[model samples]
Target: MAAKTEDLTELSNIISTNVKNYLSHVPTPPTLRPTPPVPVTDEVAAEAREQLLLACRRVISLVGGPIETVMGMSAAFHQTTAMKLAYDMKLAHNVPLDGSPIALGELAAKTGASEETIVRVMRALTLQDVFVETAPGYFAHTSGSAVIGIPGIEALIGHWTDESFASAPHISDALRENNFQPPEDSRKLAFNRAFDTNKNFFEYAYTEDKPMGARFSQAMTAAGTARGPYNLVAVYEPLRAAPKGTTLVDIGGGIGHVAIAAAQKFPNLNCVVQDIGMVVSEGRDGLPEELKDRVEFQENDFFKGQPIGGPGVYYYLRHILHDHPDPWVSLSRPISWEKGDSLGGILSHIASVMDSSSRILIDEDIMNEHMGPEGNKMTITLDFQMLVMCNGKERTEAQWAALLKSADERLVIEKVWRAKRNDSGIIEARLA
Candidate 1:
């Protein structure tokens, strides 16, 4: 009892300090409304807010007791189910944005869902503060529910709750089938198994379920835009000093926005954005007239040897490597990677094309060795999401080192420009 009391006091202290720090910087108490995630002008305030939120979670877990914690975890799926139903019924749009609440029956009529169903779902959401009960039987939007109004957010929610959620339960079964490999092939994983499809997740998304395909694409865009740490600012210093006339090949870069930005930032350097045929066409067509001369969109697969090669060239891969299984080099001994298997095929191709003066810059989340709730909720969830949907696995710093060394004995991680706020970083590799 004494130890428990001490732990509770420590948690309370943390919460009190962080709350004061946040208020000192912002001078405003947060309300149940949407606002910018971070105070744009104040990094200190942003850090404080993050700390405060983390401390609150810790406090909740500490006080809630083991039974309550486990029960909440077990029933967490109820929230997702409610959210998905709400989304399908277009609940966000149904709710009046003018701070007026709609009665249960009226909301059901508008959304074409049953009043009974709406009542139960709203109850689940309201307890979570997604929506609030303005009166005895009326509902109003809160910050949590209001986010569904954002562009692409609905698709993201739908993708996760529908296809992704369905696949997750079968993960253990897929693991058993694959003998518990850290990462199994996409065809053998939970996604393919759940959907009864022989094609990979991407193929199934695009072909089998067109709506899901569209949702996945939009969700990816939404996610890409949200990762502030992975942007060009993270590694601008090194990129600024590159030779005036060098080629930067963005392998598997989609739609070429990053390549376009790179070309605009560094006028003297040429940029080549490479992807599949459809993506290359879209990127080429979208190129601004000013960057036409410096930026080229080419259709090429990374698994095959790099089509463009030479000295003084830089190969850029953003969020590309984490899509495949890892430890391409066998832990037992040095061995060549199988064709089209893991990062081995991809890395070997890049290694074969690189000259002594060339470099491979991979922009990815460099995960920690251990997944701690205080530090990492996003990356750990993402790692599992990748496992279920595809054969991908996020690599830690040590895992990256072994994989790179296996690709080529000469290849070395020259430097890593880690983001200040997150695991996102630029791993710069060069031939030793």
Candidate 2:
């Protein structure tokens, strides 16, 4: 035990040193950094961030004694609770924009939350470095609090706090009821169980509350923005390689963000954004003035036969496949996939319709081989989140290769394009 304590203390010192080293180079909080922060796209900054993340994980691993460790695990719910309260109350919005500290009473009055309650919640969040008490009974924005105010970020937080937080606790029961198999039915997953509904997550989000659905799309955009160097297009080689007039189909692309970005960047490329009727209509109506001639919207159920198919057409699926099990891709033809299945099925069907030179680009998290304490946080968190909500999963490179092979014997992995700053990899497959 003495040796263990000494090792932990040494690890703690290493963490402190690394953190100081990082701050020396990047003096400002990421939120306050210039629009398109240098650190976000810089290779050196990314490497430093990775090292800090690893050290933090090492520290996290040494957190408490047996009883304290168990209690700490149980207390994980507290962070979610505090985040939800602050977001719902718009407490972050109440903070001074210029970074000046505000008295606790003044902030409470601005947000209309009880001052005492606000104090408790804000103080709890401060423990996470979300907000800082600059002086007694006063609060100010830290990097975290400031960033939460960005459009779509608060929505992402809202989605997690309200929707995801409610469902996470039910994962154990969902598994037990499903015979310990990762469920294949979206309607039977923990999200449905928590909501006491048979509808899938998207159906509930879209049909139940239009605003919520819009927020989800916005949240996705925010996520893309946060990825910096890993933004969908930057990691896709095929898009860069495309000649003028290349028709790119964005399957299940919401609001055509990726397509719009591509169209704006590569003037010669024509994009077809496909999705359900509602989303396509929105994308079509909101199509930026400049992209009007270059990008078009189409309502096509991906589960059904891909409507636009020809030789040389590029198909892009960003953050789509992991939502369901492997079997749904092929079944998309016979029936709508209220439940999910593998990418192999859809890949096979698409491959059947493709011209010999056509390629498919899959943008998603490629789980690392060794996921220890310092594993990629987004990938690790989302893997379990997928299991609970849609019975889906994140795949590794080997798994991606296998899935593509199983989808079409003629399909071969062309290449994998990865960004220096993000966890996602773009897997390219082409007909052999």
**Which candidate leads in TM-score?**
2
| Candidate 2 accuracy as TM-score | 0.89
- Root-mean-square deviation per candidate: 4.0, 3.7
Local distance difference test scores for all models: 0.76, 0.77
**What does the lDDT read for residue 81 in candidate 1?**
89
Number of colliding residue pairs in each model: 0, 11
Worst 10 residues of 2 by lDDT: 32-41
* Winning model by lDDT: 2
Name the regions of candidate 2 deviating beyond 4 angstroms.
1-39, 63-70, 230-232, 330-345
Residue-level lDDT tens digits of model 1 in 145-199: 7777676777788888899888988989888865787444456688987899876
Question: Which regions in candidate 1 have their CA more than 4 angstroms from the true location?
Answer: 1-6, 26-29, 34-41, 182-184, 207-210, 285-289, 327-344
C-alpha positional error of residue 47 in candidate 1 after TM-score superposition, expressed in Å:
2.9
